[model samples]
Target chain A: MTATDTHRTIEAIFRIERARLIARLVRMVRDVGLAEELAQDAFLTALSEWPRTGVPANPGAWLTATAKRRAIDLLRRDRMLARKHAEIGRDLSEEDDAGIAAIEAAMDDDVGDELLGLIFTACHPILSPDARVALTLRLIGGLTTDEIARAYLTSEATIAQRIVRAKKTLGKAGLSFEVPRGRERQERLSSVLEAVYLIFNEGYAATSGANLTRPALCAEAQRLGRILAGLAPDEPEVFGLLSLMEIQASRLAARIGPDGMPIPLTEQNRARWDRLLIRRGLSALERAEALGGADGPYALQAALAACHARANRVEATDWRRIAGLYDALRRVMPSPVVDLNRAVAHCMAFGPDAGLALLEELERNDDLRNYALLPAARGDFLLRAGCSAEAKLQFERAAALSRNEQERAFLLGRAKACSV
Target chain B: MRVMVFVKATEDSEAGVMPTTELFEAMGRFNEELIKAGVLLSGDGLKPSSQGKRVAFDGPSRTVIDGPFAETRELVAGYWVWEVKDIAEAVEWVKRCPNPMFGPSEIEIRPFYEMADFGDVVTPEIAEQFDRLREKTPAR
Candidate 1:
């Protein structure tokens, strides 16, 4: 391969192996911060040397070895302290090729699970929820702090500090580098799953950006969810999360038109939906129900998504079942967002008038005041009710409030169509 | 053992966006869990960096960095000092607390030194001063 290809290959390998590499290093050093720094140093070294020597056959192992050597060098440099130096020397001597091979093999064996553990660690409750999400994406998702900040429309400095402080807190607390257990595991797992779902939702329908959907983020979230499902095969929420992402992802191909504009669900070409994703989603949902975890917020959402997945057309969707699921979700996790969604379902199940009443009730709450979806949903209801003038006004308002380019364009199209 | 858990502050966190009702409810559930498990000593959110001041001592000269420090990442948002049996026990407790941020955030934990930990080199006077300082500061 050419030098450029070698560099690209290294980057790809790092993207896939970054979490595992850091996890293994953390295990050895017993310091998350130091482990990450070492991992970064290794990446820098690869950037400088990989091009000249060509990529190694086992790039992940090579990077680990390189990082370990650097760590040993640093330890040796601190040899002025006799006792500390000796400790370092002892560790280095003990970690011969055989030990290194064992560590590498162990890392490769449960990499997915280890990555999930790392995610839970990053999302630990000790950190602020924002820090948890930021750290998880940075460490487990292999995303840069800057990337995460941008994803959330925040400053890079804010994200950088959150990460630094998060690592420091973990270190200071001397938190163990392992997945939590029992009740603690269940709680932390919820946050981990929530973070993953948040990432997927942003990718599925970007809150704000030039593009409507960031397919890469969606794919990554789905990949992580699948890994989580495998690691915790009996956890219903895991399957629920996977089912939701899979079913939502199945519609990606049909959600955009030939010109790259947003396509309303009713307007989407059902033939273009990925049947494989739908199948995976249905299977995951079944697993979740079989595990008796059908009552969770995620599972309930997945069941609602299943209604759409089973439908051949938008009209064929079991809107009443979806409405019932939303009702359950509201009871479990009450929020204006859920009510808005329920309103949409009610419209389909009964009529636009019923949905409009629910929407109006939700509108009284200040939380949805700035939420663009309220007006967008209202506009849809109006359009169906043949109130073209009122619908046009709501659509225009929605178009004005929306930050997403695709969403704005979609709303504007709806407004223009009403005018016609 | 006295362990210090550092809660990294974010811009929103410092702004005193009084945890929303939902956030409080979530945190209350977590705190109840922590208290029930006997891991929580005391904790509270911090004021914005703009309201605080950092004094750096070098030799005899002290440099005071005003609140709203330019570096958000470097600021300490809040902290908790827990009396635990050991680091392992502290970790178990921290694992149960609710995340304080609405988005990605982190809390760091560090061990505090007791007079007994200082061996014979440290005098009682210094220990007294450390105790006084600990008293002046909030539990986090």
Candidate 2:
């Protein structure tokens, strides 16, 4: 291969292996910032060596071995300093040989566990959401600070600052590089999942950006979710989260109009929904069910999305099944969002009157007072109930409450329709 | 992005030929890889054109056309819908697909247009808003 081709190949291989290397390094160094520095040192070493050497047979192991040696060398030097050794060496002792042996043994431990531990550490609840996002993208996704900045359309300096502060915060917290167990594990895992989903949504919808969606961010989150699922294959919630993301992502195309307006699922052209993502989602849902995660928060949501996916047309949708799922979802994860969605399912499954009854209760709930969808949904039910005047008022309110330009336009359009 | 992959029909497929056991197994393995990678959304093989019909529309009139359609090489013998990071990734996956026909065959990848594929509508203004929001909100 040409020098340039070799360079690109090394870059690709490093992107895939850097996380594993840092993950292993973090275990040894006990500091995320130091582990990343060591990992980059290995990458730089590879860049200098690989072109002339024409790449190794197993480059991942090669880079990893190189990084491990760097970690060990750094630890040894820190021990000589004594001051630097006080922090990391507290876990071991001044005996360099024994400490090196333990470090080597850990370096040889199951890589999956190490990778999982890395993800949890990056997404620990101690970090701010922004810090978690930046750290997760940097450590878990192996993206550069500049790349993360461009992805979020923030200044490179801002991203650089975020990364620096995140690392310092993590160091201050002194979080372990080992995956937590029992209740701690579940809570940490959810934090990890939440961070991943936040990234996905920000990419999928660009909550506060000029961009409606950044497909790259969504794809990146999907990669993270896939990696998480692989690392923790036994965690049904992981599969459930993956399933929900896959299914929702399938609608990325059909969910929007060529004019850049958001399209509701009922009005979307179902033919545009990606069949492969839906199939993958369904099978994942099956996996979740098989793993007894059928009632998982994400699993139930996936099941609800699956209801729409399984139908060829909106009329054919099994509304009753969806309502049943929302009921179960509400029972387990009671939220105004779930309750509002339950009302929607009831409207579709039963009659507008039944939906109106539910909406009546939701209206008194302060949590949803400013939520546009509640009024929009109410308008939908009222319109169906042949109360167009009230429906028009509700749609107008919904349109006023909506912050999105396209959604407001759509809601106003609905209000206009109600007038006729 | 979502992409549609078409496995163009070969002469063998046009004759309603079935895949050999080995070929079928190989294709199955390839499909398993796609599914497990969460790339393959849904896909299926098609019957020969002899079993198909088409309805052509022009203005207010419609014409019912029956099989077997001409241009067998242009016919689709199978297709898959996949969600991929990009078209290049889809290309890599397709390159790994086992030959669909007993002989040489062709696979085509077409990515579904996203909102970004439309005009440059995504503005930097909203991103600035997001930055402001991020600064105001503490970590959740």
Candidate 3:
């Protein structure tokens, strides 16, 4: 075939097979850094030979075979590294073709466990959050450092350094390449989920930027969530997190305005919401519920979002149920943010006066004094309660406190509308 | 199962340039092959991103933003929803298709989550409800 065609094929093959190849290699070598190098070496070999030799029937197997051979050769050549050689030098006596076939055969076995191990290793809590993100995307997401950097809107050098540091930390810590057992496994899983959700939240609402959202980050996080959900199907929280993200993401299309400002839920056009994502989210929520995680923190959040997703219009929303959910969430995972949301839900379910009372209480609290949303919510309630002058002042406060330019502009616009 | 194959937009597509006749004919033949193989469920191309708009959100408020979105890499020029046995089978078919763009392009294949993929979480009642929903709207 043509040169470009061959290149595209090889690239696609590498994207599809890299995770499995590296996972298996990591299993053998017990070093993520070495495993990655071996996997890349295999891809380099394919780039050089596949164009001329034609694509193999099973390219993944071919790549794995090549990587396994290279790994063995590297280990054998390192005469001083007796421990490294001893650790990986297993059944290496077979000659060329037989050896390749044996390694390929081994790759077909226990890929699931190997991949799970790789994921846990990448997301080990010992590494810093930044390092975990970089490593997870590189190893499990099958993304290059450049791709990870581009996705996060950071410099390639920064991401590269983060990854190198992560691998070095993993090596120094001597983390095992196996999914931990029992409670430890759950803890590791939480770390993995946290990293994914943190990435999604940053994309969903950037902490500080001209734009309200970064769609690529949301997409990447969701992609990683899906992969995790598939890997740990029995984990109720995996489904919970996936459901939550899916439903929240459905609103992405309706969350921004023509002026590049943030849009509140009440004003968003329901028709613009992505129905497919809502459906997916609902199905995932159902799965979470069936798996006995309906009250789980993420699942509860999913239910809250579902309350909105199910409504055809803002007026049709089940405000009372949403309020009730907030109450439940408060009991289970009582955070200031949850309490703030609960206050709004109470107002929506009761009246503007009721919400105003809660906001007034929250206002006296020092913890939420700097939170822009607290003021924003208070302003909305006051405006609805016919205290427009007071609402105007609150909106101005929110605008000043907000870091995101789009959000500040939105709040300032609210302030202007209430000025009269 | 069904997979959505997204044809990523090239610079030409983002600029609203139409595919050349040769490329169009080549894609047509490719689609015909898929059709003959009973793999092609549906296919369509999208207009340029310039015609699109984004609605930004902050709680209950929304703001609309007109597009010629800065990120061309995120744009899709076309998509095909194909029924395939699995992702590997889908990849095999994609590998045989002619280039969909004059310049370098990408096709991302994502599987639609089948009810079976959800395992026992999809109870019989839920499965029945899903079946009814599918009957109401067959596209899924």
Candidate 4:
């Protein structure tokens, strides 16, 4: 093979193997940062040797063996600096096969467990939300700092600092590189899921950007969700989160118009929806349901997305079933956002009056004053209820509040279309 | 299962620039690989959207819009219909493809709707009609 071809192959293989390699090394070295450094060293070694020697038969094992040796060498240097083991002869013969075997054994031990541990460590609550996202993408998603920065539309230096600081914070906290058990496990898992969901949401609707959505970020989050589901197969919530992301991501293509304007769900061409992702999502939903997670927060949300996916057209959507899901979801994970959605679902199932009452109730809360969607939902219901002039005003309000350029344009277009 | 792989229009493609000889040779090798693996059903590259036309419908009236389409991102330069096992396998194969344009390009993989996806909505008569159409089409 050509040199460029070998380099590309090595790069692809390293992207796939880096996370597991670092996870295993972290288990031995007890340092996330150091483990990543060792993993990179192994990659550099591959870059230099693989072109001349040809790729290793088992490149992952070769990389792991290299990283393990680096760890032992570091340990040997530490022991010599301490000089406390002089009587015990801290100097080990470099040809010691048993010592190498011990390191290799630890590197291969419980990979799944080590991966889960790495995930939990990266998403540890000690770090801020941005730090958690950067660190999680760096370690779990196997994304480079440059890629992470591009995904977030930020400077690479900023992302690099976030990852470095996050690793230091994790080390300073003396966090164990082991998955917590029982309630602790559940809580940590929730934190991990929340970070993943947050990334997906940001991607689904960029908080403030010229574009309506960032498809790359949405794809990244879905990839992360799928990876999490593979690692924690038995965990119903993992499947729940995966199901929700897949179903929602399926709609991403149809959600934006050819002119880059936001296309509301009812108006989107259902034919453009990704059927494969929907199929994957429905199977994931089935798995979550089979595991008795029908009422779990993510499961319930997935059920809502499923309702849309199962429908052949907007008019055929099972709004009543969706409203029922929202009611159940409200009980489990009560939020103004869920309530607003429930209200909108009520409008579809019942009438605009039912939804308007709920919206009025929501308006009394000070928290949702700047939320553009609240007014947008109200405008939708008002338009459906034959209050076109009132709907126009609400659309204008929504357009004024929206930070997204495409969404603002779409809302303003709605306002312009309202009857005089 | 079938996936319609869209090779998105790049500046090189939209500007009517042909691919390099190396890229054409690489793509030929790739297509041969796909055919050998029994993955590729049909594939073709199209001229720029300027050579295309769009028919818009308003009620029963037809309005034909001439291209070049303003939105370059929405334009397709080529397409591949591949008979793959699933999305994952399709993605795996697409990842191995050489760049289709002279510069950077994107290929989007979208699955075709099987009659089964419609579930009970597609009646037996419709299924038979679709089956007949499938039989009439060229075999993969």
TM-score of each: 0.59, 0.75, 0.71, 0.71
lDDT of 4 by residue, A1-420 (tens): 788778877876776577889899988888999999999999999999999999887787899989888888888777666666465674456645566676777776877678778888888878888998889888877778988887778899999999988888888988778988998989899899999998898798853335432556676677777767766778898889989998998887678765666687887767657666787788889999999889999999999999988886678889999989999999999999899999999999989998999899999989999999999999999999999999999999999999999789989999999966
- RMSD to truth, every model: 26.8, 9.7, 14.6, 13.6
Docking verdict class for candidate 4: incorrect
Ranking by TM-score: 2, 4, 3, 1
lDDT of 4 at A303: 94
TM-score of 3: 0.71
| Model 2 chain B lowest lDDT segment of ten | B131-140
Between candidates 2 and 3, the lDDT winner: 2
lDDT of 1 by residue, B1-140 (tens): 55888888776777777777987898777665443222354566678888888899999999998877777766788777664545655654565567788777877889975434789776767655654553343211
What does candidate 2's lDDT look like per residue over A368-415, in tens digits? 789999999999999999999999999999999999997899899999
Residue A344, candidate 2: how far off, in angstroms? 1.6
Model 2 regions more than 4 Å off: A83-94, A207-213, A367-372, A397-409, B1-140
C-alpha positional error of residue A387 in candidate 4 after TM-score superposition, expressed in Å = 4.5
lDDT of each: 0.76, 0.82, 0.80, 0.82
In model 1, which runs have C-alpha deviations exceeding 4 angstroms?
A44-59, A72-113, A145-158, A207-213, A257-261, A350-420, B1-140
Give, for candidate 3 chain A, the lowest lDDT window spanning 10 residues: A206-215
Model 3: number of backbone collisions: 23
| lDDT by residue for model 1 (A1-420), tens | 777666666676676557788877776666888889999999999999878887676777788888888866665455436566355546545435555565456445555456556777887778877777777778766778767777766789998998899998998988777878898888888888887887887788753335432555776677668657756778999999989998888788668755666787777766656565687788889899999999988899899888877776666779999888988999999988889989999998889998999999999998678888899999999989999999999999999999999789989999999998
